[model samples]
Target: MKSFRLDELEAERAANDGAYLQFLRERNMSVGLYALDAGESDRQQPHGQDEVYFVVSGRASITVGTETTEVARGGVVYVPAGVPHKFHHISEDLRVLVVFSPPES
Candidate 1:
């Protein structure tokens, strides 16, 4: 069996310059930590794989397709494959736990 700690993953991500840090990957799914600074922009495009985001901390607004909603700690959002989505209007540093099905290319 394998295990991980969120604090450790977050620390690793903080040491990197990229906004996204992947911690685990398998044949069926992948997990990572995604962070966005306050007032920062999310320059991500639509993915080929379905994705899930669990807000670990902070607050922001996410636009998925034509809809936009506020997201904060303990919030969960899902985006289907090929759907346009991004985070904006960040009022605080946003940290999210990201999961992708069938891995991410």
Candidate 2:
């Protein structure tokens, strides 16, 4: 068994490019935390594995493929493998939990 605290993880910066912290990795899946400050743009690329996003705080407009939708805290979004997706129009600090199935390369 394993556990993690977001606050603690946020204090540790794994990369300098963005507030993206990949916290867990198992044989079948992986988990990560992603955050963006208000007005910041998301520059993530499409993944090779299916993904699920769970909003932990704030609001934003998420674009998947050719569709865009507004999502906020407690909202969940799913993206299929190889589908293009990004977050924009961040109205508040955005924090989200990202999950990838079958692990990610």
Candidate 3:
């Protein structure tokens, strides 16, 4: 089994919007830690991954489907496969844990 401490992960900042640390991956799935600061986000298109996001710190407004939800720390959001979504925030930085599923499943 592989083990990773939080301090062992390399932190990478996006320079303009969100920062991410790619943590783990197995045969069919991967995980990451992402952070988005306020007013950041160029409204990019979704990259076609069925994503499960768990808020780890701060707050964010996530656009999904026809409605947007304000997600705070300890909240979870499910984004459907291939759907277009974006993250936005005003005051607090958005920190989250993300999981990506297997492609052929």
The top-ranked prediction according to TM-score is: 1
What are the Cα lDDT values of the candidates? Answer: 0.94, 0.90, 0.72
Give the per-residue lDDT of model 2 (tens digit) for 16-73. 5558888899999999889998999898999999999999899999999999999999
**Residue pairs with backbone atoms closer than 3 Å in model 3 (clashes):** none
Query: After superposition, which runs of candidate 1 have C-alpha atoms over 4 Å from their true positions?
Result: none
Model 1: how far residue 51 lies from native, Å: 0.4
Candidate 3: RMSD to truth? 3.4
lDDT of 3 at 58: 76
* Model 3 TM-score on a 0 to 1 scale: 0.78
| Count of clashes, each model | 0, 0, 0
TM-score per model over all chains: 0.96, 0.92, 0.78
Over 15-102, each residue of candidate 1 has an lDDT whose tens digit, in order, gives 8878999988999999899999999999999999999999999999999999999999999999999999999999999999999997
- How does candidate 1 fare on TM-score? 0.96
